[model samples]
Each structure stands twice: as structure tokens, then as C-alpha cells.
Target: MTNHIVERASARLNESTLLEMFWGMLLSRRLDERAWALHRQGKIHFHISGMGHEAAQVGTAFALNRGVDYIHPYYRDLALSLAVGITPTDFMMSLFGRKDEYSSGGRQMPSHFSSKDKHIISGSSPVATQVPQAAGLAFAIQYRQKCGLVDPNDTSQPRLALACLGEGSTSQGEWHEGMNWAGVHKLPFICLVQNNIYAISVPLESQMAVANVADRATAYGVAGVVVDGNDVLAVYDVMVQAVQRAYSGGGATLVEAKTYRPVPHSSDDDDRSYRSREEVAEWKKKDPIMRFQNSLLEDGILNDSLLHDYESRARAEVDKAQADAEAAPLPDAEEVFGSVYAPLEEQP
Candidate 1:
């Protein structure tokens, strides 16, 4: 019932953890930036950005055991994927639809993360569809432990599944159904909602009548909490609490992270039509990466010189990944229908 991670008064914000989290956020930003450029240049077809969700993504990643925990990440999980061992090269391959893309062998869309070796589950494009699937996975984990399939004394016996979705997905029936099931069964599940105040062109006010999505958690008989998605340490602290609760048979928790979407919905969308320049500028001022960098600088954990080097290194990694992806060939013609369907036969 008691755990040190949650009991600690201060967040476990060691210098090393701070550094790792920073690198994840920085690398994700650089990757997203380059991807947007590629889309503009016609090198890539589609692109979705994770500009303002970096802190929350990376913070959540560090809270879970990457290889042990199962993660059902939505499209904008660049930082979470990178933090949990999904390399930038993997993302670049998927983005380019190259043959070497491990996630879906160039089949799935970019930012649809899935790594079997890393325990990252594949997700669908339909919003909130991953919710029920993740609940099922968590139920399996919880069932295995309860039925003695897993040794009770094992350190990683109680593995959990963490699924993330945009706040707009909360409007879907599947999201509520999955949450209800996890709550009733006391399944080891963590539902993360990144509240960016908009769903494509639709604003939050039009999407949901409730002021906060976390308020709905009370209806499920599950623990609910909200955190500043822009603040990496705050998000990390809250996620650790969620992890501890999951480990202790405390069941599901809904973490509604209030963040912003700095860029347009995707490469295809334009913010100029729906949102004002002033609103975008105000949110940009609260950029998660910039805020974290300033915090590190203030704490003496990062100086201007070190920051320059760190940032350059992260960019360099992204550049190499892009180059590698550029050189990699696209999926072969034979592979076009390779995994699409099993019942169909190919025409010669």
C-alpha cells in the first residue's frame, strides 16, 4: 500500500533524469521540425507534430519500465517513443515509408508507433480506438499475475499498460467503455489524455461541456489527477504516483495533462483559418522545451555552452536519421499487399 516513489516529498528529479528527459524532448523537437521541412519539400507525404507535448510524453516514459511495461501511444508520442528506446531512425523510416521501417514495414502511417521488442503496442488511426485494446492488454497482465502465471515474487510481476489519447477522444464511447472496464476490474491501466484545447479545427468548448476531462474520472470509480503538461518535472511526479498505484493493485488512473498544440493539426491543416496569431504566439511563449531549458540553466545543470553542444548533438542525430531514411528504399511492390489481408490472392 505504501511506496517510496509516491511518498517522497520532492520529485525524483535527479540531474541525470533531468538530462535524459531534456534529450528526449530536444530530439523529438528536432525530428518534428525536420519532418515538417521534409513535408514542405515534398520528400514526405504526411506529418503530425508533437511540439507542445514533449514534456508530458518524456515524463511519462521515464515513469514506466520501457522493456517491461506495455505502451499504447497515440500519434503524437514522438518524445515518449524516443525516451522508451524507439530510435529516431525508426521514426524516419516510418515517415518515409521505407522498407526498413520496423513498426509496420512501411504500412502504417508516420507517428503510429509500434515496437514489439520494446513492448510498444501498435495503434489505429481512429481516435480512442487504442483505449479498449490497451485495457484488454492490461487485463491480461493483471490476470496473469493474479492467476499465478507470473511469479508473485518477481520484480516486474505487475506490468501495466499505458495508453494515451488526445482530450478530444474522451468524447468517444470507446474511451468511456474502456475506462469503465478497467475501473471495474481494477486493471493495471493508465489512461493519459493530452488536453491541447483543440481537436483539429474544433476547440475544447465545442467538443466537451465539462471544464476538465479529469472530472469524468469520478464516474468510473478510478483515481483522477491533472498536471501541467508543459512542466516536465510536475508531469513526471504525477506519473510516478500513477505507476506506484498500478503496481500496488490500485487499478486505473486518468491523468489529464493540460498542454497546447503549437503547430497546426498536421502538415495538411492551417491554423490561420481557425486560430488567431496572438493565441498561437502566447502558447509558443510557453514552449515546453524552452521552459525546461531555462529551468536547467537556472539550476546550473545546463550552461549556455553545454546547452549549445547538447542541442547540436540532438540535431545531428536527427540529421543522420533523415539521411539514412533518404537513402533507404521504399517498400517493394510485392510488399504492397503482403500484410493487408490474408484472404486475398495477388494478381500476377
Candidate 2:
């Protein structure tokens, strides 16, 4: 089904880049499985699986200029974080809540990814807060350009901010407010909503009256698009266009990627309580990772041996990360308030 899609993508991206995307998706899946195992063993407090959304996350991550554009990702963006350069070791340290964890120094929970070097802003526990923050970042980029702080003539440098959220967050006022502001200001922002059919136990039909989340973008006067989230190449193409528009001074874009959450909302939630087993089974047949791999094999870009090698490497990396993280030290109790506020000496 996706052979033609892969062929089209090959026209725009090389085989190496496609393989990198596959590796990222595979690594994300392995890491998510590891996190779930750690939680079940009582080694971690909570776990949010990003199993089905890896295609969308990784596809969009590769579309952006990784160290340049700011990313305000929701908690489910495990694949996105990894594609943007966050290592498996970083994720393991975060899961183990080690003192040296890059995201928050062990303050934030697992899956709440952040990295200063990668330009991934720290996210809050509250949903949709990153929407406004992303808008602000985009505005700042434009402001700097106007103030001559950034070289306006540098066409190679694209200043944009990407904010990702679940479909449920589209109901939040922050989502609307931030998107509206970005539209009104013509900010370099790309708002991506991963529609996974359900928000916790609540289904999409109950959340909004619109057919698609991107429909809301119409009210904000921004370009709205919907894509097949399971098709990594399709997602990459859409994101490339959106990023180009933003870089060329076009207004914000609202992209709704139709995906599925193969697992429950979190380890604590029971998916069986609300959804049917058959429904999940149906979606499993469309697993993005499997689909992408099949497409690569059909196009002769990948083979069984290469796939096996990549999967083995990914599993080994995850195992090493987990072992290293387990041995790492925890944050000291005395420094509980360390990152919360600045010390008086550094206030000035």
C-alpha cells in the first residue's frame, strides 16, 4: 500500500535518510518497551508508551533543522526526541531519575523530554502549555530577525518553532489561544496534533464536533492539513512543505496526523476498560514501523539482514542504557529546591 509513497519519498530523500528514520523508529519502540518493563518491575514510577506515534514523531523531527528550530513536544514524543539527537542513555537516565539526567536533572517524570543542546524546550505536566510557549519562541525568532540580532539575509537559516500535542489538547484553551496568536502574528510556527482516536477513555466523537482536529485551524485563519500518520514518508513530505512555508514567512500551519495509540494512556490506565480488543487488533495490522519496513524492503532500500542488524543494535543500546542508569546516583535530597529557583548570588 505504501510502495508508491516510499518511491515518492525516495525522490526527495536519499536511502541513507530513510534508513535513519527506520533506525529511529526501531530505537523508539525498543526504548518504549524497556520503559514499560522498568515500570512493571517497580523500578520506575510511570510510563507513557509512544508505540504507534513513532512514524509521525520521527518524520517531523527529520523535517526540521534539529539544532536550530525549537521543539515544544508533548510527553508522547519519545521518537521525536531521539530523532533530534537525544540518546537512549539520556532516556534511560531520565527514566531512572538520575541526578545527571539532561531533561530536568531527575525532577521531571519519564517521557517529559527536554534538551538544551537539541533546542527541545522543557515541557510542563499540564497539557497544552507548550502550545503558547512554542508561539512565544516563534515570535522571538521573528523579533530577533527584525531587530537585526539574526542575519536576515541568511536564507539557509530557517527560524521556526514546532509544537506537538495530542488531539485531546486541542480542546484546551491554551491550544486555541497560542494558535490564534501565531496566526495573527504570522509567526513561524507549525502546530501538529497527533489524533490517536481517543483521549484517555474518551473517544474522539465526544471531544469535538468537527470531523478533524485540523478543522479548528480554520477559525484561527491558518492553513490546516491532515495526513496519514502511519505513512512516515507522507508525514515527512507534509512537514517539509510546512517548514518551508514557515521559513518563507508564511503564517502558522495546523497539521493533524491520524494515528493510533496501541497501548493505554499510561501504565496505570486499563485500555480494556473502554476500548475493544478487536479495535486495537485492527490498528495493530497498520503498525507504522512494520509498514515502513515493508515499504523499504519492497523498494530494495533495506533487507532482512540490515533490519535484523538495526534491531539488534537498538536492543543492545537500550539494555546498556538501562544497566548504566540503574547504577547512576540519584539526586540528593538537600538539593530538592536547587532548580526551582536561582540562588541569591546568581540572581543579579
Candidate 3:
């Protein structure tokens, strides 16, 4: 049997792709910044920064089908959600817990993003739960010979489910269960482990034996590879192959992206209790936004002026989105009972 060779290359991104990636990263970053501000201002209950994971999210999104494919994204994957047709307004509304919020019926706290219209499943608060759900959704598609939540004969092609998680979630039973099932069934799914080296407060050394979570794929008889998660183009290339492999019946692939989390786990947690200032400083050297911007500049795709312009635009847009969200009316108290399973009388 021949082995597959999908190299994780760190080459220049196409000029257009570089611009698009930069713009996307800027939007994701600005959104996080404003969301955090909202939390501080008492406008939002909680906030999570997708800061360091922007490369992994946006790059992965560029590699998959947006409206056609399904994405079982975790809370930290705001960039992925945005890239897959989730408007800034939608995300802001979700963050503000307003009536316009599509994911939660205005009930879920901020960061739990979803879009039924785009087939991006609403992520749960339970850790690692989405891993198995993604594989299960993929298996159902193959079993029914069609896509779920849509007509079977749409000819949109059988979409793959890309589920991402924090490296810490890999310690859970659901991770192994999802990987094993995908391997056994040759399901069209991709499990991406974002190894940011901290599970809220627990360090990576305490979580897994291997340096890379990708190494664990050996147990499931699947291909595993690690890429520079801070390198957007590199992540993009790997995701491209992973998505193509799954769509072409090559089965599941596990990509362990080595990244860092710039902010504390959430608004409530203080990272200083567990991590050293020196450690955070070290990780800052690998900042995804800076690295990706350098990649673009070195490739002659962008200059400092262009980068600044894009970021300014993104920041302004984020401000507008936040303002719109704050101005939108909150969901009425009784409306909470609306979307949950409908009325008992309506059930057959």
C-alpha cells in the first residue's frame, strides 16, 4: 500500500490569499478586543479571546466549504465561524444576548457561537463534547448518503465536519471516541487539536506524554501531523489536504496546531496565578498575527501602511457591530420558552 505525503510547508501565501487572511485575522482580533471591552464595561456576561487561535481558525475555514460544509466549532473558534458566513452583527448580537442573536435564542452566554443556516453546530460548554458530535454527524451523513438539516438531493457534495478543540480536551474520553469512530468508519471528519499548552490552568506537560497531540493519532490508525499554528499559511496548507482527504474518502486526519493563548481563559480567570510572566513573554514571540503579517510582508504582498489600513477598518467595523448589538433590544423574558422544543401541544 502506498503512503500519503501531505507536507506541512511554510511557503509564501498567494498575494490575494495573504490579503484575505490578514483582513480576516484583523477582524477576528478586533472582535475579541471589543468583546473583552464589553465584558469589562458590564455590557456582556463573559468573553473569550480567539486571539492566538486566529490563524488556526481562519486558515482552517479557508480550506473547507463554507455554506455547504458543516463545522462543529468550539467557543474559541470565532474566526472560523466568521469565515463561514457568520456576520459580525450576528456574533455581536450573540455576545450581547439580544433578540437578534441567532445561536442561543438570547440565552447562551457570549462566545458560544453557532449558525444553523451555515451548518455550523452550536458548540456546548462541556469540554471536548463537540469532538464526538462532529464525527457522529459525519457518520450520519455517510449512513444516509446525504447531508443533514438539508434536502439530500441538493448536489452540494458530501461535506466534511471539522471539529477543533483545545489541547487539554484531548485528555477526555470523547476525543478518543471521536477519533476511533472516524478511523473505524472512515468518516469524513477532521479533528484539529489546538495545543495552546494550557488547559485553563493546567499545563501541557501534565496533560499528555508526547510533545505533539498529533502523535496520538497512531492509536487510531490515522494520519497525524503537527504544524506551526501561528503560521497561517502553513495551517492553511495542512487544512487544505485534510479537507480534501476526507471529502475524497481518505478518512479522518488529526492536525495538532501548536499555538498560545494570549489572554486569560475567560474574564473571570486570572492566568497570573498559574503561569509565569517570562513564559507568557516567550509565547508572545510566536504571536500569530505578527507572524502572519511578517509572512505577508516578506512575500511582498503587503506593506506596513496596508496592514495598518486593514486593521483600522476592522477595528472600526467591530466598534460598529458592538454598538449595534448594544442598541438592539434584549429578548423578552417569555421568549426564552419559544425555541426550546416548541410547545408540547405542537409535538405529534
| Candidate 2 lDDT for residue 184 | 95
Alpha-carbon runs more than 4 Å astray in model 3: 1-13, 146-155, 342-348
**Model 1 per-residue lDDT tens digits across residues 150-216:** 9644666438899999998999999999999999999889999999998998999999988889888
TM-score of 1: 0.94
| Candidate whose TM-score is highest | 2
Could you list the CA RMSD of all candidates, in the order they appear? Answer: 3.7, 3.0, 3.0
Model 2 vs. true fold: TM: 0.95
Write candidate 3's Cα lDDT for 148-228 as tens digits.
Answer: 464444447546888889999999999999999999998889998888999999999999888789888888877787988
lDDT of each: 0.88, 0.89, 0.83
Candidate 1, superposed: residue stretches over 4 Å from native? 1-10, 156-158, 340-348
Give per-residue CA lDDT, model 2, range 82-199, as digits (tens): 9998899999999888987989889888889888778899998799999989999999989989889888557555489999999988889999899989989999999999999999
TM-score of each: 0.94, 0.95, 0.92
Worst 10 residues of 3 by lDDT: 1-10
